[model samples]
Target: MNIFEFIRDPSQIGPWFHQLLLSAGMQEWVANLIGDVIGVLLIVGAVLTSAIFLIWLERKIAARLQDRVGPNRAGPYGLLQTLADIVKLLTKEDVTPDGADRVSFNLAPALMVMQIIMVAAIIPISAGLIGANLSVGLLYFIAMSGIASIGALMAGWASNNKYALLGGFRVVAQLLSYEIPLAFSLLAAVIWTGTMATNNLAMQQGELLFGFIPGWNILVMPFAALIFFIATLAEGERAPFDLLEAESEIVAGPNIEYSGLKFAWFYLQFFVNSLLLACIFTTVFLGGWQGPFVDQFPLLGIVYFFVKSLLVLLALMWVRATYPRLRIDQMMTFCWKVLVPVTLVVVLIVAIGARITPDRSINAVIISGANIVALLVTLGIIGRSLRRDVQRRKAALPGRSTAQV
Candidate 1:
């Protein structure tokens, strides 16, 4: 393809590069290997570059929410602040604690970053544009994504600090607890679409529902979307659910002992993972790469995908800025008691709805209606429970009367 054609259909860039290598008299296997390496490099580069930008973006977002200026002195509107931080981190002395396990202490941060890259590999950026379009992409993502918890454990345990170890324990608890609802939420989407491939999930969402609304999973499975988003906030260790790194309690969490570039890896992984999860959420629910006229101009898909992902990321930032951190008990209780049960019900309802109809639009409408009713019921139950707790607290007060309570 020529430049203009490639511009219109960026998805073909991979194949085009492969062909270009072939035209240079390279062997087929060699060309394929080179192409794959280049693809991996590109994915890594994109992720790392985005992490730098997101760091600044998040700081600015938080500053705006808090009514303050953030990173203004480093560069124009603080655009260069993250770059300066990167330089400082690189120049800092690399210090592995005197009693630390050298191997695992060094390995943990790289592993943390590696897992995020692995999950990103299967994500479809646009039509036919993915590093590895595995058939069981969703399952692969889930398996690979869990490696972060292992990394956190490694960091905490290998550091030999009590607080770090506690942070590790919290990571295990928080990630494992939320993974259930996260998996169930994705299961709802799988049941509705009858596929677990990430690309297929996005492709299925390309059509228009009833010839008007975008056929995004979020529209039909709002409960699943809500559950998935909430579980994701906990999984990513954003505020409120950020018990893993509750600096107030655990100092700096799993990577507390890390310094210099070692610390930067964990720091980079935080922002990168948040963005990746938002991308995954967009792919599964918000219709990744599906936009108007995208068929005619495939490059627009990338724009649509990133715009949706950014909005999700911004929502995450807003939550981080707005809410106070939850107590460990409260976090766990919300997950096991609230998110898990609600997600299960959402999955069952979706399964029934999908099985009841062959037409997607019909199924969507039915499922959407069912989701609304389920939401109302869930809210009513939660409200009633909260009222009872308040009443009980009032009754237990020494000088409280029924009227005052």
Candidate 2:
């Protein structure tokens, strides 16, 4: 391929590189092995490098929300602040508590980072651009993402500290509870799309509904998108669903006993996982790499994909800046009572809608209309519940009259 061809279609670069390796007198198997290693390294490097920028971006965003200057000294617009922090962390002494389980304590951070990386392998960046376009990519993601909680639990339990152990318990309660709603939300999309392959999901979304509207899952199943977004906040341990690491309660949670590079790994995992979840949301709901002129200029798909993912990431950060962390009881209650039931109803709606027609546009319209009704009904129910709870509280108060209540 020529420079312009590769420029217009970056997917060709991978195959071209492999071919180049073969032309360099390498055996087929050796070339394949080398290609695989390069792919893995590139993915890992991209994720880790992106975390640096994400960290700074989040700090700047949070700072602006709080009306303060953020990270302006280290580099232009404080771009190097995360790098400076990395240096400081590297120079700090690595510490493990005396009573901590040596193996588990050390393994936890690596495990957490590794699980996130594994999930990244399946994320479709653009058309023909993914580490592994597995047939069951969505299922693979759901499975691998769950492993991070195990790492958290291991860290908490092995820390040999009471507070850390409590954090571990919270991790179990929070992650496990949210995973159900998360999975169900994704299930709604799967039912509607009839595919679990990430690339196929994106490809299917490329078509415009009614010749104008983007055939994104978010439009067809808004409730699923909302539920998925909320569930991911909890899944990623972002506020207000950040009950696992509520510093006031658990004293830095599972990673309390970790310091230096070990702690940095946990920290890196958080930012990177948040970005990955946003990428997943973009792919599954926002029409990954689907945009105007994408067919004519395939490289534009990469641009479109990241732009959508960035918006999702900004939304996630906005929520973190706006909401206070929820209490453990409240967090669990919201997941089980609200998110879970709503997601189940969404799945049911999609399932019924899909059975109504073989035409995708018709199915989308049916599902979208049903989603509107479900959302309104859900909001009304929630409002009524809140009002009743307020009235009961007023009725119990000695100073409150029935009229006032």
Candidate 3:
């Protein structure tokens, strides 16, 4: 089937395995079981496909940003580069350090891979297309995301390398620092919509304010949206917040001992989290699977969802190209001292605004205004604090002026 047909009728589009099972006149239960297995396989295939595309895209974007040519060989603009890398990794040796804990070292990568795959289950491509629709879907997604931190720690401890162990500790600190603001920012959105189900959140974003402007939660809570995106940047270990594996400083950090496929697993998890971040951002803030005429042609939702997600993904790539990595101290300080307090105030503002206001449209706008105000206020306070610190330090230095210092 073509892309249009597949988008319009996902269940009807077959990979032949499920089709063969159904065509054999299998019982309903058996057919469903086989189909589900195929669905999982298909999802895995999709992740691999996306990884291949995104890997190439990242290098191209980075090259462009750095003013150089990217891959022009290997099948038209280096589309086959990722494929070649995969083959190389799969064919290479798998080495284990003698001091490494064999069981934990082997199991850590698999555990992280499992958690990454689990996230795909709740990512909605369209209204009717999802692996499962739990009532607490958003909550579940948040909880499951943190489990991979354990795998990170395990990878570090199991390696018996000092750098790996420090990397593991850094992962724990980074995850804990970011996850709090991420959760509260999400709560601010939930406070406005009053549901933890991702689908319901999507539905809430479906309305339009002036018939053309989308009623996206981002419009109502831009601060939360910004905070959520930043937190996810840290969570995904992207640039600027990716101190966990600062090559110059730590020599590859937690995965230093992992060779071949095990290292590939670590690499895969980064892009997976990136993809999932874009999807969740679409669902919560960009109106998931929502666009013009989607009501009339519901299948168009898949197109809309992908388009939105790609735009977000591109923005992330741009950020990676533009920003330099933060100091570990700065990364943690920004999360705890800035994001946490700001998100808490935003949540409180949302809660109060929702309670006193009768109309959702009016309340949403008011809450948005309040969030912006709070953001500005927080920035002002931070600026003042930084200036004060600078002044005190300059005073302590007898020979240094502020500019010279």
The estimated TM-scores of all candidates read: 0.97, 0.97, 0.93
List clash counts for every candidate, in order: 0, 0, 0
Candidate 3 local accuracy as lDDT? Answer: 0.85
Question: Candidate 2: deviation at residue 31, Å?
Answer: 1.6
Q: Which portions of model 3 miss their true places by more than 4 Å? A: 1-28, 210-212, 401-404
Q: Per-residue lDDT for 1-405 in model 3, tens only?
A: 467766555634544446667779997679888778877987878875687788888889888988988987888988898999999999999999998999999999998888778888777787757776678888887888778899999999999999999998999899988999989988888887788887778877888865667889889889889999998898888889889899988888799999999999988888877888899989988889878887766787889999999888888888888899999999988988898888888889989988776777788778888888988888899999999989888989979767876
User: How many Å off is the CA of 70 in candidate 1?
Assistant: 1.1
Question: How would you encode candidate 1's per-residue C-alpha lDDT over 372-396 as one tens digit per residue?
Answer: 8999999999999989988888879
Error (Å) of candidate 1 at residue 232 is: 0.8
Collision pairs in model 2 = none
Task: Report the poorest 10 consecutive residues by lDDT, candidate 1.
Answer: 396-405
Off by over 4 Å in 1: 400-405
Give the alpha carbon lDDT tens digit for every residue of 350-380 in model 2.
9999889888788899999999999999999
How well does candidate 1 score on lDDT at residue 63?
A: 96
The positional error of residue 57 in candidate 1, measured at the CA in angstroms, is 0.3
Error of 2 at 146 (Å): 2.0
